[model samples]
Target: MQSITLKKPAPFEKYNQPVGDRYIDVLDGVRAVLVLLVGAFHIWQQSWLTPHFTLFGQRYSLDFLLRSGYIWVDGLILLSGFLLYLPYARAEMGKMPPVGPFLLKRFLRIWPSYALNVILFFFLAVEKYNGNGAYMAKDLVTHLTFTHTFFYDTYYGSPINGGLWTVGVEWWFYLLFPLLGRCYKKKPMLTALGMMTCAFVFRAYVSTLTDTRMWFNQLPAFLDVYALGFIGADAFVALRGKLLQSGKKEKRLFSLICLLCVILLVYIAKAQASSSGQEGIRLGQMAHRFPLALCLLVLMISACFASAGVRFVLGNRVMRFLSAISFQFYMYHQVLCVQIRERRLIPSVSETPNRDSEWPWQPVFTLCSFLLPILLGAILTYGFEKPIIRYFEKMRSRKKK
Candidate 1:
């Protein structure tokens, strides 16, 4: 029995009204999940617990789940790429947004909340300065400018939230998005290919360096990730547009997308099992970032095109709430995990901060790691983020008048 008598999808507008952010609930849900994955990995970092099991007469390890957290950061990066270029993708069908308002909104949305957190953490982690005024000053400067990733001192071992490297990368992407978006608007596939090609060349160049770990995470390394996001956005819009246009319930298409997502997940786990290294897993990313990003794209698209029940499962009210505060959650979780260990908030017998914080504390610390981020993220999002955003928006309206 044929599932979908697939045919050329009608023009996008014939199905959906327009490309607007309101209906993209699944994206926020996925963002919530990605942030949680990253947070879990960081929590696991303090306690290197390998969770495995035996089933169906075969032993399998879920260890890669935590180990692969950093890779999921690429997923977040890809999401950023999708969002930044989504307007351009839609412009393939309709008019593009004015560059200035869009840029202003993006910067205003991120900077206020981010700057507050960075400054707060600066005070919290100031001990890392060790009375070395020079280093503290340098770290603060780089963070303020979003150039922290460009320097070794401010990157992997950064005193002010090592996880912040992603912010720096995203900021760079934002600064360049206008140009990238325009290029994509004019020639999307070509622009994506060009970005991916340049990224590969850049990675090859960086690999030649004496110690590539410090340099591997710079923005250029993840260009392909961003490029994939652009491609994914365009594809999602077109595919979903057509799906809606068919006016036929696509249970089969939904089933196929879900199966493909599952297959990709299994394939990735197998790849992780095959690879053995702690080196760039910081060392290993460059080798397979594209395929992984592609897989992420599939999952993201699948989520979007899923059945109403599946979409609601992912984009439910709870997920929406978490997604709203995901940025703050991500920023706070790892740092709080470290604080929990350092302050002995959870009892630990490991005198030297051992990998296994032992049974009670491991679970306790991980649980706190999960909860504290939400509490803090909610505080920042509700208390500070909303009011500041409204203020800027009002100013924009006044200017329009």
Candidate 2:
């Protein structure tokens, strides 16, 4: 079994330690923001297709932004890779024995929360469907094993836990991390950059040859997003080192450049989406997204290095709390939104043709659905996730002793 070699805390005292300490907290804020955005976009999105806002019978479609909201998921995916890789990058420099315990730790952290959500969703769905044991059983099994993405034919569109599909990709990313980490052990920065580049190239080549909207092609292309994030984590650490060496003016200049890069990348992503059609919604998935994601990452790095204001907000208790719950919110939201729409608990007069009896379940519902899940997820996160995590930590501590 691989033992995690705990890296001793760095002795560098000149650089701001608070920023480093609260880096994950900042990420949590970003995570919260993204989750809320996704939820809000999902809420009003169903009618967004043929948008109508009426005040005394004058109606107009307002669908422009909502349609594009799907890209947020890609952003979320990229963020996942970055955050997941951050810890591993920061861990003990020396090698662990093997991958076994490392993988087990990860599995334990994620699965408890995940399995609870699945069981909850299944029972709720079963209650609604009434004794359709086969369907519920199938969903429960697939979800528990994290193989829902593989069973495209049996339940392609069925969203037991709507946001969970990305998790399938996430698990794969984790499994591959040891190999990715090994490459970085030799030359951390370059390896990160190279992996990011290779991922982009792989996706770009595959995307052109095969229709990315197809499950066969699209599923694998996601690796690019994950890799980009993992690379971003490495790059951020390197940039921090450089900033520590440079003067304050240089750090500020670096931040300014990062800001400009972010703007340029956003513009490019928007431009690409315009050219690509609906599948183009997730602009981040396209190779064009690498620059934008990179820019955002750099901006974050710059904030860590140069800006106290950014640091304060990022490390603020409220923001951290929201961010902590964001993951739980993300995992359980889609189905809740769907249930709300299906029951017509939330009214919408606007019609979506060929989807009769099913109100256009807006993508914004994806956003709105996040709330209840956040609430429920928090309960689960604390009551379940916290305990499980602490249990592992305790076990590790005992082993060390």
Candidate 3:
């Protein structure tokens, strides 16, 4: 079995480490922001209060902000691609680890907690199989194996957890990473563009199909977003020297340019959203997502070379702690949200007599939805996930010895 030599740490490694380092505090900050956006979006979607207010004579609902939060999932996917590709990129400079151990590491990192969630939700939430026995068996098999995303027929939507569909998408990406890494190492720009092109073509073709919902769940639809992340990691490694050598003025100007690109991308997405017809919506999403992905890449790159003020803000202790437990939070939040909604724990719009009133109950419901999941996530992460990971790590170390 082939094994890579793990490189010794540089003296200044703590100052500016690579993507797969033990800690990238800024990234934890990024995760904090992403997870909060996701949690807030979910809470706002289920809440009864309509938070509408006027800005510059234009009426906007807070729900619009919540709806836009879904875009952060793309950011999350991008981060995954960046981190996953980093080690392979490093290995290319030396030797690659045996494929079995690499794959095992990925499986162990994700599957234990995921299995727990599957079992919990199966007993607590999933409906009994009342459909055709054959189809039910197919759905169960696909869902269990994290291959549900590929099928158009069985379990097009998530069978167990709505948020878990991303797991299926990400698991495939993990499976494909070795091959993708080789192409990326050979021709970084060409490979990135090719992946983006394939994503666009797939999304465009899927738009014409009757099963658009299933298409949306497919990995091909989001490949560009993931590709942008790969490209971002490449760019950072390639450009770090020049970026660090540049003056403050130059760095600020570059950051401004990136920010403008993001704003422009948002405007384009808004235009597409307002366009009439389903074709317009699908085509718009396909076209707009690429640029948005690029924008996210730019922001991540900028954060790496950001000024002290920016770094300090992103590297806060609380944000880092939240980031540490983010996976657990992501896995559990939706389940709790669904439970809260089903149990009628919160008042609905229909139940309220005075719609104009300050809606006191909404805050309480929102707090419960946000806090309860986080509390449970803390338990799952510290109580279960970390222990299992440590045990496996110790076993692997013993084998190495």
Top candidate by TM-score: 1
Residue 6, model 2: Cα distance from true site in angstroms: 41
Q: CA lDDT, every prediction?
A: 0.77, 0.63, 0.71
State the displacement of the C-alpha of residue 317, model 1, in Å, after optimal TM-score superposition. Answer: 1.4
For residues 1-401, what per-residue lDDT tens digits would candidate 2 score against the true structure?
A: 99999988653432334356325556655666667756655654432333458888887543434444555666777787777667666666774336887788889878888887878776676665467677667767888887777766324644466667777767877787778766765576676666666766667665665345434224456655666677777777766655555665765675576567557655654554465554443333464556656566665565566544454555567777777777676776666666766776555564442144344444344345555677876887778887998999899889999
How well is each residue in 1-401 modelled by candidate 3, as lDDT tens digits? 99999999864444343232334567778778878887777776666455789999999765444655555677788888877776665555457556677788888888888888876775563455554567666666776788766776544444566777888888888888887877887887898888888898898788787646666647888888888777777777666645646666765665576567557756754555465465555555666677766777777767666654454556678877888888988988877876786676766564542243436667777788888888888898899988888999999899999
Error of 3 at 342 (Å): 1.7
* Residues 37-86 of candidate 1: C-alpha lDDT, one tens digit per residue: 88878888886666779999999886777777667788899898988777
lDDT of 1 at 161: 82
- As for lDDT, the candidate ahead, 1 or 3, is 1
What are the RMSD figures for all models against the true structure? 6.7, 9.3, 7.9
Ranking by TM-score: 1, 3, 2
